[model samples]
Target chain A: MQNLALETVAPVVESVPVPKITAKDVNVHYGEKHAIKDVSVDIPAKGVMSFIGPSGCGKSTFLRCINRMNDTIPICRVTGDLRIDGRDIYEPGLDPVLLRARVGMVFQKPNPFPKSIYENVAYGPRLHGLASNKVEMDELVEWALRRAGLFEEVKDRLKDSGTSLSGGQQQRLCIARAISVRPEVILMDEPCSALDPIATAKIEELIDELRANFTIVIVTHSMQQAARVSQRTAFFHLGKVIEEGVTDQIFMNPRHELTRNYITGRFG
Target chain B: MSVLYFSLLLVMAVLAFALARGRASSGARAAAFHSRPNYHGLLAASLVAIPMLVVFVIGAILTKMIAESQALTALDPALLTDPLRRGAALREIVEVANGRFRGNPSITLQAAGDTWAYVQRVARFSIYGLGLAAGIGGLMFALRSITPDLKARNRFEWLVTVLLMICAGIAVLTTIGIVFSVVFETVRFFQKVPPMDFLTGTQWSPQTAIRADQGGSSGAFGVVPLLTGTLLISGIAMLVAGPIGLFAAIYMAEYATPRFRSTAKPVLEILAGIPTVVLGFFAALTVAPLIRGAGEYFGLSVASESALAAGLVMGMMIIPFVSSLSDDVITAVPQSLRDGSLALGGTKSETIRRVILPAALPGIVSAFMLAISRAVGETMIVVMAAGLAANLTFNPLDAVTTFTVQIKTILVGDQEFDTAKTLAAFALGFVLFFFTLTLNVIALAIIRKYREQYD
Candidate 1:
């Protein structure tokens, strides 16, 4: 693993952008289990970054750390530096509620609120006071839905429950909800795992379009998906980042033994 | 003693016949049958026991009645003047004839004893004849119908199912019967006293004749005072219970840890187990005096048995009724909704207040309605804490008598059945039933609407 990091292939030959998020020797412990070891990583702005790992490898934990979603769990403890856009989210006087609004997340299971489709999309905007009036809120909801490519299918039934939509449409409705708040960044945890292949393709296309406006970070188990949607990919193993590089190179070229094995379907 | 054992033996014989028949007719391919052989045994046992038991009970009752009547007829007619005296004399004659009496040295008594003996013999003969005829008739009919292909077990089970349905139907029918009885008696009461006077008249004193020549005073049948008293007490009770119970429920469901929840819930429920009579005394002796002192401090006259005292204690009794049910309904609201609200950056209190409470509103309303019904039906607390005076005013501090209290007062001591005093209790009960039923129906409708919202 040390030799692979040193080799570093072309390194993109471009000026590396300033890190929007930096984790300095971050470690998380859930009771007796050391979920994430001393891991350091930096994520840059305005592009899709993918975290690829086997199950229970701390990929989801690391994503939750960005938004302080782990605060909801009583036993989970994170020690060391984790900053978003150079701001310490865990600093004294920092409110997780405020931080969550600034750093939005979409869950793996596509849990849309048991509310009307319009309400589902407008919920974040309403909570964050993103829109001042009903008309503005309506426009914001439509914009978010349009961005998620769900407007055409759900436009006629904005008043219907979000759950009444198909599995794929529900997932998109969740995405629309996340985007409605106009957060600086969106964290998606296996956003397409519960969707069919067609929906998966649609979400991948939406992710590519989303990268033009907002910084997007997604956790996915599908290597091909990571290659298709992400500009950069990080491979995790045993709660440690084994390799991080351009997605194309990571999939096709030589890398760490574990990363190579995982990419080639030799082993998880 | 032998008869019961003999019946058991007959049942066993029938079971053996059915089991053997089933086994023999099932042929070499035993597994081909739809049901097991024991089912046939049970069916045959039921067929034998049911008819025999019915005959035994009927014959026993009939023979007992006939024997008693014959003994009464043989008794000296001068000793049995009325139905009450006749019953007592007949009982004594039966005891004497059975050799349970210790009297001796009288020829006429001995002759009467012989006549009693003859009556017993005739009754016994009648019982034996009826029992034997019914038993034989049933046995023959059942045996003739028995066949190898007969699915007696299925038919018998179906009959049992219908019997259970009838039993349940009887419970509903019994409730209806009781309601109608109250309604009919109340109608009779209203016929004597005009409905308008009963409903709108203020005074409730029912006068009775003090002497044979003195006519009873004109009794006031107004129910307004009782209705007002009931409303005042119920209002105070709801005031005490509604907010406290609902808040406690919210805390238990949303905020309490598992350890605190497990301990607190049962302790709260223990309030419901305390007998209402005990609470009544506590209210009467302790709370009423304390309230009077408090009222004195405020320079107000609070009656010793005030509506406020009774209502507060009754409210305490019904707290568990509201809290436990509300807790269950609030907890039943999906955790996903909470998570969704929190994920959207809503504060915990905000999420609970806006989302969870609204979703659980109907259930909470139903819980409150149930509590109200319980309050209306409660008798003991009001009887002890609230006074016998049916004051028509709505003031909680004033002495008041509820419908239940009035009913208890009217029926407490011996009174003539024909008087309006005794019958008014039924009328009051009917009004109470109507009020509680309306509350329950409205609450149920609200709950149904909310259920449909979620479903």
Candidate 2:
């Protein structure tokens, strides 16, 4: 692999109370192809951090590493010092299953399990044994659905199939499912990418509300989405993080030329 | 004479193709032709071949009728009073005409023979003339019709479509024909033996007494024992195949690496391709004795040829059916469902059991139904390993018989066609057909209901 001689900026973060997740020199490879390379960043507690990039720039790859979702791919390899709350997630003693319980994900496409709406929301809690009785499980499902702002619309048809919901509703259902287990961190991989503008606005609003209780990391292709929803924004280009800073400064006065060109839609 | 006509038709077809292609591609209107010159040529050749073949076939059939009628007319009226005697006389006349008769013939028979030979020659000559005329007419018509605006390609394609339709029709019509034939025999069997007795009686001895005074040979046509025996064996087979096949499918779909799956799937399917007769021999010779020995060692008296042995082998034969169908449906389950469960902190087995299996339940149920039908219809293994006794016992250690085994035993001998014993096979077959058809219909219903769940 030839190393480009472009200017490399350090990961810059403005003052925050504390960082909930941290990464140092993270790299990912799918077989021989280098994907994410030497990227480092800090995600603050209880705030939305968005990674924006072009389609093949490894924003999604790096997002999946938070929950070890990429471990399902047999050929993918990850190397880095990744920690959640000062604990290494990739330590030999850590079980991916347990780590996933504390880190929930919402996919780009609305992927609700082929099950009833109630069951979809309750699935995680059931798996983790969070509820001791039927009443507790039902209450947990309703609370999760209400937190994701999808309870009123789907409350009448709780027994309906999860797939029976509309595109936007299904994504919200997935969000509800993710939060049913009450994870500390939530990762959204372009969750609003598959929805219309109306649904997208609703989800954006919900993400802002969700930031009060959970540390959220989101990957988006839309620069406006990052500007609107995120407090911190990281711009990735060619498997490297070009710049990271407060969202306002990153969009208004980007230090790196690549980040400026990408944010301004000069080229992506 | 037939060979001469066929060769003449082939030559004419070739000539028609060449002439039609030359005219269609001529410089005068070559650029304006609707179809390529090759299509025009193909259309002309087909026109020549089809009409000529039709004429030749019809003409040959008419010639045989004309020659036989003429030969019969030349015989004396008084000699043709009896139908049997007339048939024999006609045979002798045909034999003499062909110079195969070895004995001396009477005067009238010799004259009839001469007339038969003469009439055959005249009819055959006229048929050849008619066939040639039809071929020439078709060729002339095809040559005149070829022009720049003619849709020769469309016409030829229509002909090809008709040919394919005819081929498909033959397959469907043949299946209907077999069903009707079986139905008719079943009706005859019902006429001789009451349907109630055949369907509801417990006894199944199908031997009819040769004389009225013969003792202990009364035919009893009850089919209950066969039905019970069939259910017992098929039940056992399902018990064995259902779990093994489902587990194999899950292992291949979820756990096994692609390299292992590729090699293991075909090796498992090879069990299906092994001849049931070969499997039967293994069941009778090896598994049966081993089972018996095991039973005796445990202070039990297992039959030398037991239902357990046959059911085990039949189960082996049916495993591929279950696994292959199951593997397909399990693999067809979308990846998103699996991912959703796994991301929720569900263990791999929990995800498979709670989420993936429920999503694929409809398809898996249908696969099991199809496998059960296959086990029900299997015969050779049961025939060899389960003894010829109609023991309606549910115990796997006892010898038993099934519907297919009884059907095979009834049909595999020289016997009078109309006897109740022989016709019973057709009845059993009809019942078996109904059983499998019902199962398949139910399977299709399940697949139709849930096919669109994931998409």
Candidate 3:
């Protein structure tokens, strides 16, 4: 009876055409503790895919692995095949530094560089040597800010410290910073977790707009946000992905018992 | 005798605590105590200890005065008129009373000695009686006041706070006292040598005549040479230490693993723990000759004891100060900032140079200033390695003397305090103090201004 119910309720996502990122049996360990255990998922290109789970469920950890940001931790170790555009990112020849440029990240809290608003937006472009001259760099910075929907709010005071902005503006500035590098993918780790409702709504709207051009992966605790913004939703529990499918089906009719329990608030 | 009183006071205080705690705990069964039994015990102990300590101090002083006055009464009035004679007679009387006198004593001296012994015994007994009275009275008062309603903890805490304030005030008052003493001596030095001539004149030979007919030049009291020499050596020291220490801090803070940092930071700080005298010897014996050899190879004249040698060794000694302070501030920069930079695809070096360093700039600048101040105030290295010649030049190859070195030279042997040469040490000390104080003030101001920037 259980298998019949699961088979009927589960959404069939068999036609994921040319997924932008693919992971097979990916495992992450911090020293002796396994944080992510044999997780496998394919993230399709040019869409918002949200990972929804309870806290400490390895959702953020798995998110960080995409950009190889986990390389910074001394004890953290990752194994198994992880790829972007069918190229293995974990290969010894592929530099994590260059990989990060191709895959930009926004942190849980809004972190703008302790510099002028112009400098914060220009940092990634400058680092990647994207702009050739002062005029081009200014244009690039302005374009990034416009893309992140923060250009009009901060157009008058480009010279002010980036930290001087409001919480929502700072998050947008960080988004601009990430987008300035022109990455193929953007990974956001609970980016609106530290913002108020209005700020969260604005960021959610920006994320929706951004998915038209970039393969965006977001980790959020709010199932409402996952259902509202993402086309696909992956449910994680106890360091494992329990189920993944189209967002409406995942929320309305989860296949796995664990996924259904989590979505319906029976138990995290 | 005072030892006996001290023991008596200790016993009384302990007994008072035990009695008060027992009373408070027993009363707690009937009613509720506002404070714990331990607080009640502390209040009792403090009451006994404070009053008894006061009585002990005042009694000791009063007894000495009374014994000295009583001994003086046995001496001739005419003999006591002269201050010198009075001091000698008092010393003899004290020596005889203590049974340590060896010289032959006149009849009056013998009588005075006997009176001194008698008066000392009486006075000591009276002090013992007074201290015991204070201790017992305080114990009884505290015992009577032990009730469940008494707020013993608050009262005891207030007393503790007052004691802590007094201890802190003593440190401040001692510093003020030293500053005043230096100010007085510096004023006297200025009276003998005009401020303009001492400050601006470029000569520093401080050899003055000891006697009216003694053969010596009335010294040139100019301090310009010493001032320039100090600046030159300290400047050299900062140049050497500033970059090396900052780089070490950056490497430790940004790149080194946690295990490496934990072990290496202490070892680096041990550089500061090496006795400065040892560093001075190293400077004089090893570095000085090496510099001289190098200078000779380069066809340049380097003194056997050059400012460069001293400055380099001093710089080595102060590296820990700069590195340790800079490391703390750099490490204190929010980890989130580093993450933000790294996530933007900035390389480690780029992130450190442009993001971390710029954010930690004020702290780094303050650390450098503190290191410069340490170099300026350093005495032993300059005294042993640098020559005594007060050369007014910026050349590091030449031997130069600092303010501390000159002060040491001026005050080494017996000399009259009234002379300009002797008083010159105090003036140099005052100037050195003022210079370091200014540096510290500016450094602290910079730190305070930028402390809240990241937050």
In candidate 2, the residue pairs with backbone N, CA or C atoms under 3 Å apart (3 or more residues apart, or in different chains) clash, namely: none
Name the regions of candidate 3 deviating beyond 4 angstroms.
A1-15, A132-139, A146-158, A164-166, B27-31, B64-93, B105-120, B213-216
Q: Give per-residue lDDT, candidate 2, residue A165.
A: 94
**Per-prediction share of native contacts kept:** 0.33, 0.69, 0.63
Model 1 clashing residue pairs (backbone) = none
**What is every candidate's alpha-carbon RMSD to the true fold?**
5.9, 3.9, 3.4
Order the candidates by TM-score, highest first: 3, 2, 1
All models, DockQ values?
0.34, 0.63, 0.64
Local accuracy of candidate 1 as per-residue lDDT tens digits, B211-240: 668765667888888888888898899999
| Model 1 chain A lDDT-worst window of ten | A6-15
lDDT of 1 at B77: 80
Could you give candidate 3's per-residue lDDT for residues B41-135 as a string of tens digits?
98998899888899878877887787778888888899888998999989999888888889778787888899888877877777677777888
TM-score of 3: 0.92
Winner on lDDT between 2 and 3 is: 2
Displacement of the residue A40 alpha carbon in candidate 2, Å? 0.8
Best by TM-score: 3
Q: Which scores better on DockQ, 1 or 3?
A: 3
Q: Candidate 3 on A119-172: residue-level lDDT in tens?
A: 999988888899999999999999999999999999999998899899999999
Question: What interface RMSD, in Å and to 1 decimal, does model 2 have?
Answer: 1.3
Tens digit of per-residue lDDT, candidate 1, span A1-268: 3234433432222233777777777888998998987667777788888999888989999888888878777789999899888888889899988887878888888777656899888878877789999999989999999999999998999998787788889888888988888878889999899899998999999999998888889999888899899988887766677777777888888467777878778776
Deviation of model 2 at B44, angstroms: 5.2
TM-score of chain A of each: 0.93, 0.96, 0.95
